[model samples]
Target: MELITSNTHQNQIIEEDHVIKKANGNFIEANTLKVTLEHLKNECIIPVFSKDNESTISHYEFVLKTKEIVQDLFPEFSVSEPDIRTSHIIKGRIPSAIGKPAKELKEHEKTLYYERCAFVMEIPEVVENVNGNKLALTIGGVRAYNQENLFSKKSPEKFKVFIGFKNMVCTNLCISTDGLADQIRVNSLNQLSEAVEKLLGQYDRNKHLGMMEKMSRHEFTQSQFAHFIGKLRMYQFMDKTEQKQCFPISINDSQINTVVKNYYHDPNFSCSGDGSINMWRLYNLFTEANKSSYIDNNFERNVNAYDLTNNLVYSLQNQSSNWFLHN
Candidate 1:
C-alpha cells in the first residue's frame, strides 16, 4: 500500500501531454442505463431523511463530487457520462395528498424516486495498450439500499468505490482488491472524496498492467482448455470442504457457462485455429461473461476474474498443482 502524503496530488498526475478525447465506446453494464450528470441532478428525486435520521449524501451529489475530484486530479483525462442502475422505485402523488390508496392514483399523479443506485465513470486519456487492446482508466461507486439503515440516527452510510482499467475492446472493467474500497463508511461528501482519493492514490497501475501483459504470453492447449471448463462446472457442485482445497472462483456457474461458449464463439478472444488460447484472452472471456452480473456484484466479480486469472498464471509459471488446470 502506498502512503498518501501532502505531495500526493502532484505525484498522482501523469507527466504526459494533455490529449482530451472521449472514451471510444460506452460502458453499459447489466441493468444500467447511460445518463448524463445533468439528468441525475435535475430529474431524480433525492430521498428524504426521517425526522430522527441525520442527513447522508445523495446519489447525484456523490457522483458529482467524485467526478469533480477526478477531474481535478487528472486534468488531462476525459470522463465519460455516468452509467446508472436504479431500483425499488418509490411513488407518490404529484399534489402530495394524504392516505390515498395506490389504485386511486392515476399515472399522472405518480412521482418517482429510486431507492437504490450505482454508477461508473471512465477516463479515456489515462489508458494503456495491452497487446493490441486499449485499456482505459475507470472509476465507479455503488449506493445500494442494503448499505444503510434509513430509520436510524446519524450514522456512517456505506458506499463502494473502485479505480481500475476498462478494456476498450469490450468495455469490460479489470479490477483487483487493490483498486476497490468495498465499504467506505462516510456521513459527508468530504469524507467520501477523501476515501476515493485514498483508493486512487494507493492503486498500482504499472503492476496491474504488467500482470495483464504477462497473461498474453501463456497459452492453454485444446485439451487443457476443455479440462479447465469441465473442472469449473464440477467445482460448482462440490461440497464446501472440497471447494476450500482449490483456488476460489468468484464468478458463478452461469458465468462459467458463458466462458465456455465464448471460448469457441467470441470474435476477439476466442481460441485460435489450432485450438490454443492465451491466458489474457481467457481472462477477457471471464470479464465478458461478467457483464451479466448485477451492478452490486459487478465490481466484485471483475476483481475476482483478475485474481483467478492471475492465480492461473502463477500455477503455470511454478508448475504447481491447480485443480482448474490439472485433471
Candidate 2:
C-alpha cells in the first residue's frame, strides 16, 4: 500500500493570500479569513448574510462552480464546460459567448458532491447575474461579473474588487437552483428544518469526495510507472487514524475532481452543486466583522493526501513535464 499524505497539507500549500490593500478607498478587508486549521473541518459549513442586506444571503453557488473557484487554486486553469442548460425553475439558462444551444448533463454511473454544492447556490438570483448589464460585464453561470458574487453578504451592500489571479478567464451562463439556505427564511421551525435537511443531504451524499482527490493524485502519478500501473488502479485514500482519540469517520475522498472538472470544464453539466462552495455555510466570512477575508486561518491537512507529492504533484504541472519549474 502506498503511504497517504494528508490533503490538509495540500490545502496549506494552497494558501489564501492576505495583505490589507485598498480597493475603492473604503479599504475592503481583502484577505483570507481568520478560521484556524482546527476549526475547518472538511464539511464545516459557515453561513453569512450580505453586508448591505443582512436579511438576505449572497448566492454562493458560484463557489462550487469550477470556474468560480479554480483560479483561486490554479490561476492558469480555464473552464470549457459550455452547454449547461438553463433550469426553467429560473428563466431560461443564462446565455454565453459559446455557440450551439444549451446542453444537458452527461450522466455518469457515479455523480459528484460538488454537483450538490452547485445546486445549493444555483437557486439564487444573484448567481443568475441580475446586474451584469449595469456593470457592463458578464457574470453568473457563464460569465458571473456582478457585485453580489463579490462584496460581503450584508445589507445596503459593500463594494470590493477581486482582480483575476493569473492568465485565467471566465464566461457566465444563467444558472440557478432552489435555495437550500432558504432555511433561514422559514417562518416555522419545521420548514426551516426541511431546508437544513436539503443542505445536509447534499453534504452526506458524497461523504468520500475528500478521499477521492487524494486517490486521483496517487493513481495519476503512478500511471506513468508501467511496472506499478497494474497495482495502482484503486482511486481513493481515506481513514481514521485515532478513531478513539476524537471524532468518528466524518467523510472520505471521492469524485471531487469529477465534481470540479465537470463544473469548471463541462458546460452541459450545469446544476446547483457545480463544485463552487456548494453550500451557504461554506462562506462564513460574511458574519466576520472588524474586517477579515475568507480562509484567513491556517488549516491542517490529513495525512492520506500527500504520498503522490513525493513523486508527481509539482513536476507534471501545466499538463506537461516542465523540468525547469520542478527540480
lDDT of each: 0.76, 0.23
lDDT of each residue in 156-246, candidate 1, tens digit only: 8888899888877777778877999987998788898999999989999899899987777666777888888888888888999999998
What tens digits encode model 2's per-residue C-alpha lDDT throughout 242-302?
A: 3433222111222232323333333222112322221111111111111121111100011
Model 2 alpha-carbon miss at residue 141, Å: 13
Model 1 lDDT, residue 211, Cα? 91
**Residue 321 miss distance in model 2 (angstroms):** 21
| Clashing pairs in model 1, backbone N/Cα/C closer than 3 A | none
Q: Of the candidates shown, which would achieve the greatest TM-score relative to the real structure? A: 1
- TM-score attained by model 2: 0.18
Mark the regions of model 2 whose C-alpha exceeds 4 Å error after superposition: 1-54, 60-238, 242-327
